[model samples]
Target: MLRGAYLILAGTVIALPLTPEGLADGPWWPAPAVTGTSSGERYHAVEPRLADIIERREKAWKAAAAQDYDRLQHRSARLNRLLDSAIGVLVEGEATRARRQIRDLEDDLRTQTGELARLRTALVNAPASGCADSGGSLVQDVKCALMPDARTSLQADIRAVERRVAELRAERTRLLSDLTGSLQALGIALPASDLEALLVLVSADRLIDTYAAYRSLAQVNAALIRAAEAADGDIEVLKRYYGFHVVLVEICLHLHEAFLEEIEGKWLPRLAVLRSEAEAAGQQARRLLAREDAPELRARLSANVDANGLSIQAADLYAEHLRDQARTATERWAGLYRRHQVALNTYRTVALQGDVLSVMRQSNRGFAELVRLELPPLRDFESTALRDAVAELSERLRLSKL
Candidate 1:
């Protein structure tokens, strides 16, 4: 029942719909990617982030294969330090300076624009934020970057983002509630369980990238305050949040590779067992049905096997679908590196993470019909001998998830 992507978060299974179609309902902003050149050209340059991605990919995948998910996630924060140092060494100083030149110029323009707006507001009560509203590609980015009091504007923007995130949570809760209600209506009657909470929190930190999208703005503000050698509480706050974003980016990049092994080493095997058991049950039911002459008995036996059989197929398809999702995300990542690689987007790619979550959220609607189908009560089965055994098997499959 997946429309997008999903994952096993700290042993908790989550349904992530990160699909293009789902993005229509969300905000999507992507950083522009630059193309590469031949020998010492654009695309060929060594990117520290790319190298770190390879390293983290290798290490993280090893851990995930061993089923150490908690450790895998906790250690991601350390990679931020490792990555920063790596950039200082792997990437050329001149290239970085050159890249920042354009970014700096944009910052300057925004600063001047904000200043003019401030003057206008002082002379004539033109809306204090009106100038900021007209500031950049994204209004909040500009406001947080240059307009008004740094602390006030930044905090307000942060609050606004928090509100949006809250709304997303509410919407998700309702979606899950509706899903359960729909399932009950369809006769599955899913039990109230912890999986619903696990599923809801699956995308909890999704908006970290959105905060990082304000990276330039926040950084510029922090840098100015630092230059003045003045104390700013928001300075530490901004640093902590930005640092957190870096950790997440590193983790996500590695996950694009490591999580695939998680699927192979853990998830697929569970599904294989389910499918195998279901297949056997189908065989047994078929044999029993063939020997029975009552039409009613025949229908119940056939329906149980057929319904449960479809659940197994749906689960299997979802498992394979997750593998494909990780592979696709990896391919997109390969675009960023130098080897065999296409030159890809700037660091601002992190800002566009909401869309990535949207992509993960996409999945086949059929998965909506419980991947492990809740078979009708076993008492309805014709044969008394195999009914208990088959019922137990059905329950086991029903509880299984990727």
Candidate 2:
């Protein structure tokens, strides 16, 4: 009976309005204690700012849905800070419950922020015309203006998020549970509860940042296109489908270009640098090719081939594949050779005062000596390959002509 009375008394004390500073022992009273006249008045006072934060968060979320990544990022950052400030002032008891709610909002914000950072990084580093969407231009894209059925599907996604968010807000303890559940349904494994604490502090607007939503939109657009293609009846729907397809293709092409740049700039060059060590390895290859035809050379080539465990096709395609690889290498090397030639010419003509002897000397530098020692066979290999590709490509062309 005494324990029950104490529980009732505790509840009653928690329900009362917070007095001025020193009365409540903190800057703000907890949600559980926000019942009496003063607390209600205080809640009403701050409610408008909280509501504004909510509005900003929603706008950011919508902008992200529309692929307005820039606006989404800006608004998301603003919302997060505001939410943090609002949640900071509450008293401990009911405050803990409010904090739990705040944690949910922050987690969404942090996730969105991470997503925003990824999108921005992609845009910044993306090849060509850079920014995917500037000042809502991407919103003008056909994919954003989906047909009625597609729009209906998107609305369903929005409603699902809204419903989930509402359920979390209804009971503070369910916030993390709701998020974990949603992620699981999406086939995403969330971090452990302790790790999730960091995410919980993120601002409201940031909730829209790391955009799983755009990817979702793209998926929906693709599905709608498939559906329309199956029907093949509605002209209007077909038009929308084609428009969306064009946008998808354009974005895909840009992504491909970015990929190509990475290969060209980073990966392909490493291959060249490795192969440069063998650039003049052609004399050695010729000897091997000749030996393939010669009894002694054939013996050596066959023995070496066996020792290396290389396929027999290496010999059969030896000249052909070597030619192909060499041609590609030379086409690339030509760019470097051209730059070097220009530098040599500039030194010879401009610095050496047009002396042909000086130009020859410039051509045969210490670098040539290094090449002589290190890669004497490379140039020879390249020359042999070039001769072969010309013959092969010419044969193909001649056959085509025939």
Candidate 3:
């Protein structure tokens, strides 16, 4: 009964709004302290910023129902745009392969041409002096003449070389034509030079860089034409499936925005207070160390100074971490926002004016992927653990794999 009463008293003490200076017992600075308001509540109290995020997330959960999902058709269109982005990457890859083969063909053609030239040189010079043409001795010339099929053999070899060269040239031509047609079907044109550069990037497997190089030109003038020609069911499926995900993504964006705001406003401030306290404590300790005569007091002050310095260093690192998280989340939000605007604008365009999900728009860098940055020191809605929807959204969709 006495323990219970003490717990209630502790809870009441903790219930008051507290500050870093007010909480003289310093553990509460970084992680806060347990509210011992009652035996039932002998655990750490949630920070206001964190509590606000939880409240916002719960509200979003209550509001965003699957059936109540707004803009399914718009989401579907976004899905198609993402699909086109992925297909564009694949089409770029195919062009890369085609160009590589062309280069190989060009090399083969050069080799065969050189061989043909050598054979022709040999044929013309053969009958005149036989082995003598090649600086052979008189005895060798005699042996060369003894070989009656030498001229015929050379002619046959020339014919074989001619045939192989023709086949390679034909194959190269067909590949070029088919590659061009496929690209045209997807409303793209790979310039020979750009194609070469793209091929090199592809050889290096630079996915993000290739996206930068390729840009917004990859669209679907006639996607079905290409799809039918290539048997790309997977690409079609992405267009069909991920449209549903955009609804959830919008909801998660709200959660993420609240998360970022709390970090910027409160969580960061709390960290600042902790760091300031450490620095102030250290400075005071250091000054005392300079004046103190007692050996034990000096030792204690020196340790305090060291501890405070470490605390300041830790605060700087945490500050940097918070800023990075904010920047990353901001970029992601911007990308998605830009993409949605573009998707909406598509509705006013010629193609999508009448048909919503009939086609995809030309996307900027936003087409790459949607990646989310994490906010540290989470409580309650640790999205990854609780089958949270945001964790799923945070994943980078490998457009190339799609």
Question: What is the clash count for each candidate, in the order shown?
Answer: 25, 23, 2
Query: Candidate 2: misplaced stretches above 4 Å?
Result: 1-171, 194-211, 231-236, 246-402
* Candidate 3 global CA lDDT score: 0.40
Which model, 1 or 2, shows the larger TM-score? 1
TM-score of each: 0.31, 0.21, 0.31
Residues 232-308, candidate 3, lDDT per residue (tens digit)?
44543433222222322333233234335545655466666666777789889988999999999999998888767
Return the lDDT, model 1, position 222: 28
Task: In angstroms, give how far residue 14 of model 1 lies from its true place.
Answer: 26
Which sections of candidate 3 miss by over 4 Å?
A: 1-249, 347-354, 360-402
Q: What's the distance in Å from true for residue 80, model 1?
A: 11
What lDDT does candidate 3 reach at residue 350?
23
lDDT of 1 by residue, 1-402 (tens): 111222221111232222101011112222223243221232123233434554554344323242223333355665645543432222222222222332343335445555545554454533355444554667667655565654355445556545555554555455556545533432235454532321221111121121122222222222322322332334443232222223333433433333344445444576578777778888888899989899999999999788667655555554554455445445633431221111012112212342322211221122433233232221122233334334333334335665
Score residue 103 of candidate 2 by CA lDDT. 50
